[model samples]
Target chain A: MRKDDTPNQDRRHALECMLWGGSGLLWTVAGGVPRSSLLGTPEAHAQSAQGGFSFVHISDTHLGFNMAPNPDPTVTLQESLERAKSFRPAMMLHTGDVTHLSRPGEFDRAAQIINATGIETHYAPGEHDVVEDDGKDFFQRFPQGARTGGFYSFDQAGVHFICLNNVTNLQAGKMGMIGAQQLHFLEQDLSARSASTPIVVFAHIPLWVVHEPWGWGTEDSAQLLRLLARFGSVTVLNGHIHQTMQKVEGHVAFHTGMSTAFPQPAPGSRPSAGPIRDLPPGELRKLLGVNRVTRVQNQAALAVVSSPLEG
Target chain B: MQSRRFLLASAPALLAAIPMAQAQQPATVTIDDHDYAPRELRVAPGTKVVWNNKDDTPHNVVSTDNPRAFRSRILDTDEVFEFTFASPGTYSYYCSLHPHMQGRIVVG
Candidate 1:
């Protein structure tokens, strides 16, 4: 949908993660296809006591951002996080870019806000998270096992989750790289898992190539995807474009989550990729949001949803 | 007669010295508002080019060349990266964070 649409006529727009709604958007993917419903609906808003399995996915919070697109990113981040909390997600999966420039203050503020929800959060690094001291500061703040290089896997909710660090070593043009060392680690980590288990891989950059010129896609993610192909249910999540872009290829489903900070131009839409800085007053929040994915009982595909902060 | 002869002999040296003098005076590329003002620049050989990041977001200058000509760590706002060119060649560079924010420098 065009960003200029007013409430008088909100048209229906399909699949490409555009500014589709003024209020929160709740997307449900069945058969590997996305279908969104208004969260305002009574049934969609219902809180389940036996919330089987769900997690909040928020990306690009960019806490220090105070610019044309968003004067105060923390404000909207708070609202989006609060919205996720209301769902009572089991854990939070932060795809990456926790801060704007990897500043300590920004990370501190982001950590405080995210932790307030009382949910366990897992993180992958965005290139923004590693700009300072060659990512030493970022690694120090969120250290994993010494051998992992910030890459690790764990089991949760009968699903296997892998978090890879592709942003640490960026190639020219900002393409994400999962180096040989990390790939070997991934191979070993997944070699033992049974094909029957559901697999969710979260990272800062999209594992599938979206647009090569803009570095919207990872250069070597195809190899990683090949390793995951045997799994019966594979879900790949990412955050970098700051918009909701979803795709289903064969058995793998790829989804890029929304940013809580600001919106970015679509791939190849501009000369460069950065925050969309000239939003009209009050329009910024409409494009900023959080993504939620829930696994239903015996369901092979997870239900993915997005809730913009505007409403 | 000796001074006049010296002046005539020094002509070629004087001509050769001109470009060297110009090279001493460096050019500037200011990064502000997510753009490199004067996205392209032209200069003589041995001239130095300095890129200063003036935008709030951090950016870096990286030359797009085989065995890349230059690369800089993230430059916070107001930080600078300078490189001097000794050979005549067109050097293309861009911000690693914002690749589309490209710029070129021609050392002729």
Candidate 2:
């Protein structure tokens, strides 16, 4: 693979965030960038009345994630979808990790569970999904193309959504990677897009470095971000971290969706990134949720409201 | 009658020595409830290593090394996979299903 010079840039686009425990959030664009706040608050009802489009971000379902914290994740996934069906988003974007072990039956079970919601689903394979057989079974269920290997794009509600495959072939002691082929495809994909067009990019691992020591960041994401720099209203979504994290760089905003399976510790809060098995009794469900992003007409920002699986 | 008495007398001592004998026989790694017991093992060349899936969840033993020496079928509970090391080296492996559960065997 050829190399590109690392961009001379600072990590000034670090996420600005305030996580709250409740429903109803409002996302608006201030000065052509993204800003988010609670919905019960004033700014929410005012603009929330000006609804544009809505979709669901369901990630890390981990169908075979039978370990504790959540022994049978399929149950929570069912409960989450049952709740989401009420909102009735046009589609659901599953940010990879559809299964814990990428087993055939796991994929089948996840399909049955998610299909019950009656929502069309798009996916990016997580590291767990591609750990064995190099994603043979995963791609079988979600075939983008013969050579696409799970990286592709589509348009919906005036937003260009790109699902890139970055979880396969992770090098030892390294982070997620987007190889040269996918980079070329990305450049070609975006070359046709006007900078003003809103873009939503979804992948399994975080495109930005959340915590490099734990392989939470993508190794070759800088180039991809550089290609996306010109887009005015871009929202990047991911799932590996298993918690909600947000970031912004001028016109770009990054968000990692919470998993339906189990919650890992906050970045750097645990010895290693894996299932969090112990929690104060009902608190486990509180940490699990699905993200709802609502886009309004003139606002480049999209509302990212998290509806936890709990009532 | 004399042989019977001797065998009976040695039973307790032999039972106590069983673990030491097994420990010296080869490297025995247990996959119980999503963890690799001992997490690491050391042994000599030509050592026969065994990984028993003691957990209900299925697990497969696959080496992370390039040109992997051994890869096992998904072993259900109580199933086992065994391999003999002919050369001296460090071999790192994990349950392909649950990658977080890792173990390393050092052969000398």
Candidate 3:
């Protein structure tokens, strides 16, 4: 049978088994050593159970985008929101590129639709949102500190969530940057937590060195990854490429979410960078959907299940 | 080929009528990479101008000098719009969808 034909629970079980079989062995050497040497106790793991939380991650709504492949993004976004309401996640995190152009109207429309869900929505800016005026409109909507853009972190449950801005003041053909200031903040944020605490990093661009030819990866992300390597469970979520891809290295699992607006050509699929061809009307809804991440317990595994908006 | 011959044949008349016929050939501008392809241009009064939207999203060419002076409806991918310059002065335009996209046209 095809991999996707399996039931959702079976698929989840298979993924869990795979992760455990492949990475579980390495975790004992890499993850277990640090937990024992640094914490020297089971107290850190006990504290994390009290801090468990699950949330929704959505990206690249592109509210004002009205073109082929997916003509009305707002409609699909509403459908996603409706699905999200059913899940009733604690909160929703929008990875970035909320609007196609940083126009006030576009931002307003996106805000209205997101707020209509009645779930608090947090955002990071994408390259398109900051094209005009260095993200003035974006900051006005979602402000950060002296950083002058949206790059902030908050703690929920037991995980330390850090949102980094990597697309500030970018030019064409250049990879995204997180700058030194954000790095300093990251260091300070993780200093208090024991090495065993989970860390969730969200940004608009990929933190890993994915395909750089299309500026899909961040330039200074390796430095950030080195700092995060100490954590026992690190999850990095991004949304610039407009597709679903996952990678695991040591303790960190990097994943990119699909866009509600449109699909982009996979890396190296097209002649040059541009929008991915829109699927047929019937298939469009299947391509654009939402993702859910559930954290069960301190020792229990986390599960990510993606479902289409139409269903 | 036919247009090239027509231009060669009309070269002398075009040169002699440069001042009077200047209004006939307006400037054509291209928008790409979130900025004007040509940041600046020179044109003649009463000339008709065109702005082509080559980017992925929709864009609007709006004049900063006069909010209502001239505005092009939102131009989507592969769409184009033209406007006539009746006054003699430099006019600045930007993507209303993206205010940071700015350009200037000098109409003499």
Candidate 4:
């Protein structure tokens, strides 16, 4: 199909561009442009793989969820983690909804499985993650984020990563909110960096409005975007809709990751947003998995590939 | 002065007119399929309203008015939250978790 005819086709073309390089394929940056090749090819052996790093982005594990879509979410989560582990990423960014109900047992089981992967994981809280005791349980388990109220930033291998919280203090008839306090922090955070920095921002809800009626977007993201406009390369990654969506504007690229738990209907396809209740048996896992992001040393844009749990 | 005296004289009768139990006919708002059923409800001033979550997904009730009239903790499936509207006014609320699921109550 010709590109840009429809959103699905656009997504298909984008997915083709961000093809699954983890299947023994080689991805290299030539003259700052990213290109993929077969593993046994001469160019694959000739390119330098150093100075570039990759990370796995997984979201909405929903460990305690047991429903029609998938009676056993934990098994799929495990399988997704296995797929992420295959990438052998420098780190893993769990965009949130780590547990279905944010229960203690759910948190415990999720941690045990994710920790087994042994990759450093950065997290932001989804609304589901903050429901119990206003997120006391989630913060206690993921203490690294607690200090800054689940929003923090760090640098890894020359790439700056910012984790943000947009799910707290949600209001009626409104979408996700990144309150003024957090927005202020983001402004100060960006002011210190030069425009050339390749910034990777991860959050639970999509920073851009995917669908306002379903509460899939963040309310104050315009301000966040203004702060990021100066940056030469900005990648905003999120997962709340339980599907992959991509949009590019100026220097920033926006992408949402797929859930490891269940799939939600595409925006406007269904009346409301929730887990898609019925999928013919064995069809569930095809829509469930993780996304991998890679940044070559000097390339301004990061390459993101969505990997399904099953082949 | 005459209006004040009339209101004072009628206050006791008005208090006695409404049987306490009858004033509190309970109303219900069911959360299912990610939508609030009976999105608009009408009831007496003192009616007690209960919101029950029937979907597996978690939900909450919060008044849309600034200085919210009432709010509920996140409710899991089969869980319920109740509030009594004692004054005459229109109250609008939505699930704070799923903000699009909105409902309204006209109490008079």
Candidate that scores best on TM-score:
4
DockQ of each: 0.19, 0.13, 0.10, 0.48
Query: Model 4, B1-108: lDDT tens per residue?
Result: 222232344466665664554544578989988988889998876677898889878888888888889888878789899887877889999886777789999987
**How would the candidate models be sorted by TM-score, starting from the highest?**
4, 1, 2, 3
The segments of candidate 4 whose C-alpha lies over 4 angstroms from its true place after superposition are A1-51, B1-20, B65-67
Model 1 earns a TM-score of 0.81
Candidate 2 wrongly placed segments (more than 4 Å): A1-36, B1-24, B29-41, B51-64, B72-81, B92-104
TM-score of 3: 0.68
Pairs of residues clashing in candidate 4: none
Cα distance off (Å), candidate 3, residue A79: 0.2
Q: What is candidate 2's lDDT per residue for A1-311, written digit by digit as tens?
A: 10112211232321121122126444443433445666578655655455556678889998876667888888889878876776667788899889866779999998888877779998888877777777888888878632678799999877789999887766545678899999999999999988767788999889999987666888898899899987766888898888888777766778888889889889778665656777889988888888876666643234556677763
List candidate 3 stretches off by more than 4 Å.
Answer: A1-52, A144-148, B1-51, B58-108
At residue A236, candidate 3 shows an lDDT of 84
Which scores better on TM-score, 1 or 2? 1
Which residues of candidate 1, in runs, are more than 4 Å off? Answer: A1-23, A40-50, B1-19, B32-46, B54-57, B63-71, B76-79, B84-94, B99-108
Report iRMS (Å) of candidate 1.
3.3
iRMS (Å) per candidate: 3.3, 4.9, 7.4, 1.7
Best by lDDT: 4
* TM-score (C-alpha) between model 2 and the true structure: 0.79
| Decreasing lDDT order of the candidates | 4, 1, 2, 3
lDDT (Cα, tens digit) per residue for candidate 3, span A13-89: 11221011110011111221111111212432332233435578899998878877877999999987877776567
